[model samples]
Target: MKKLSIVTLLLIVSASLFAQGVPEDVAASAASRPAAIVASTSWTAAFADLGGLDDVPFIAPANLIHPPEYEIIVGDVLKINNADYFIYAGYERMMQSMGSSIKKDEASMIKINTNNSIENVREQASLIAAVMGTQAESSKRVAQYVQVVEDGARKVREQGLDQLKVYCHSMQVFLAKDLGLSVAGTFGPGPVTAAQIAEVAKGGYDLIIDNIHNPIAKPFLEVSPTTKVVVWRNFPDRGGRDSLAEMVGENIEVLLQ
Candidate 1:
């Protein structure tokens, strides 16, 4: 009877162990289910939908006036567009890089006259006029000074310390040809002599000299000559037809209405 009880106890213990194993097996099967696999796949798709791995997600909140990517630099030529902010940033960067090369015009301070009692308004007007006149005069002087400095620097670069024969040839050969002139002889790899420049100048053709001391100037030293010889100093700030016109000799009449 004791042996039978022992066998029965062993069976009961075996039954309990089998019951526990069944639940564990069911849990394992549930974990490996199609729903769980689908859920994992859906999560991955959702994560991808947030944005691809290559794209950066974070953006500055305070960048309300301009987009986060928009940046400005100095010397950047701005145009009408959305990316103009980047151009502006480029301009600012250029200005920062230019160092002392960038110049700012000084503001004129207003002077107040305290001794005006009966005719205070008139005195004030006179004071304002005087101040304005002084400011204008100061501005003119400053402009002239800047021009002189620029001209001196340009002359040094083109002419050097010695008398150099520099040429200022225009690329508008079609126009020159239209005016009954030789286009092939003036440009390209051909040797442009001093005499050739003189001939072109005589025909009212704007010629580019190899140097400033080109012998063409010897022909016409008059204040108001029939033909003009202009030396254009190319700079980052100036370009186009208007700048080209300005480079032509000062004595020539500007035909712009």
Candidate 2:
């Protein structure tokens, strides 16, 4: 009998055009980390880079049952209500309720309409490591990609963010937020209407952070010629960021440059 990988028991795929690859450094770094039970798709790449599950576990959103009732399992260290979930394999399991709106107190809140920051990335990575139980190996990878993130923010800031009115796709929203850019508007991780695109262009947005994995870029680009577009790799573009931190950090660098 095939052992049912618990992580994949009852979740549905949100769909991925291309699943980002883990960097060779990340693959090697992930060798000693234990397998954790993760509940959010956003955190999957981080875990993959961290070497959480060798088999590539399913990335599923939380089970929404009984009108906002969260069904949590024994080993599920984290559960998602509205925000990101980083479920590591060991230590005491904990759940962080991601608020619908943005705020500072929360852990890693990466949402479409919400304002997620670079700190969220660092927090997410550290929390994942903490959940894995303290070990020489586990602790070794904590804060691994934080420097890169900080560096990216510094670089973007140095380039200056003023005069950059932007519209972003939902997948790239968190990245946009982390860059601390001037975001005039946002749209889907789902289908968006042509009228909506036209409305955004009319708002005088000069930039669009497009997720290459999603369809948001092309149509929106077609909407306005003056609206410059920057591509974001939703998954492992080169599979070499080593960690989510590195991937995100590098992505921000590309977008700003």
Candidate 3:
């Protein structure tokens, strides 16, 4: 009778375990599932990468002169619709047109200022990391970003390029200043004005740091042909978190040249 009672107890224990509904294979699969992430442009994707995301697909082409102006397409809509998070800058035309349609509760849509300046990049990365629950990963990458900018600044000071007077574009002023260059005056996201042109002619600028996406250096150059113009880009040609740092380094190299 004791043996029979032991067998009965074993059966009851097994039944209890079955009733709990925990399966090893199913639990493992759920834990391992990947998050779906999408971004409006490569710039935003890079920020997401800095935030500790392994994979992020961007909608706008990186080659665009002005990525924020890109129009959203059917595929882009679908991608954002199905993604777990959609990251973007609020300035994008896509966001202006379709932002209202997005169901906020259904999917996370984040808007962050996209700039490669040391402070902006660090702050944005930290903010993004918090949202994604990847603060540990972001802290490491943010350190790398800071190092890259500081190294570039050190290189500039070493080469004596910081002493040269620069006429910088409004959009690229942050980077120009960060590299420790002497910016005498700033120009436009629009056409160089007659007043601005007059100022440039007399400013005796050594270099004109123009925006690669929307160059407005011709007027400044027309007035002062001797002033060398080095075009710098805010957007990266390739997609990756490191691309932002690479872009900044490349800009410094061009300035040095």
Could you tally the backbone clashes for each prediction? 31, 8, 0
Distance from true location, Cα of 173 in model 1, Å? 5.4
Candidate 3 worst ten-residue window by lDDT: 98-107
Quote the lDDT for 35 in model 1.
23
Write the residue-wise lDDT of candidate 1 on 138-177 in tens digits: 3333244335334433544453321322233333232222
Query: Which structure among the candidates has the greatest lDDT?
Result: 3
Residue 52's C-alpha lDDT in candidate 2?
Answer: 30
Top candidate, metric TM-score: 3
Candidate 1 residue 213 Cα shift, in angstroms, is: 13
TM-score winner between candidates 2 and 3: 3
Worst 10 residues of 2 by lDDT: 9-18
* lDDT digits (tens) for residues 1-257 of candidate 2: 22233323322111121134558997776666554333333344445334332223323332221111233342332223211333332211122322211122234432221113445544544445454443343334434555565566677688776458888887677667656677777887678887777786675887888766565567776668877788766544332235455556667767777
Give the runs in model 1 whose Cα sits over 4 Å from its true position.
Answer: 1-168, 171-192, 197-224, 230-233, 238-257
Better of 1 and 2 by TM-score: 2
| Runs in model 3 lying further than 4 Å from the true structure | 1-32
Alpha-carbon error at 12 in model 2, in Å?
20
For each candidate, the alpha-carbon lDDT, in order, equals 0.28, 0.49, 0.81
TM-score of 2: 0.53
Taking all chains together, each candidate's TM-score versus the true structure is 0.17, 0.53, 0.85
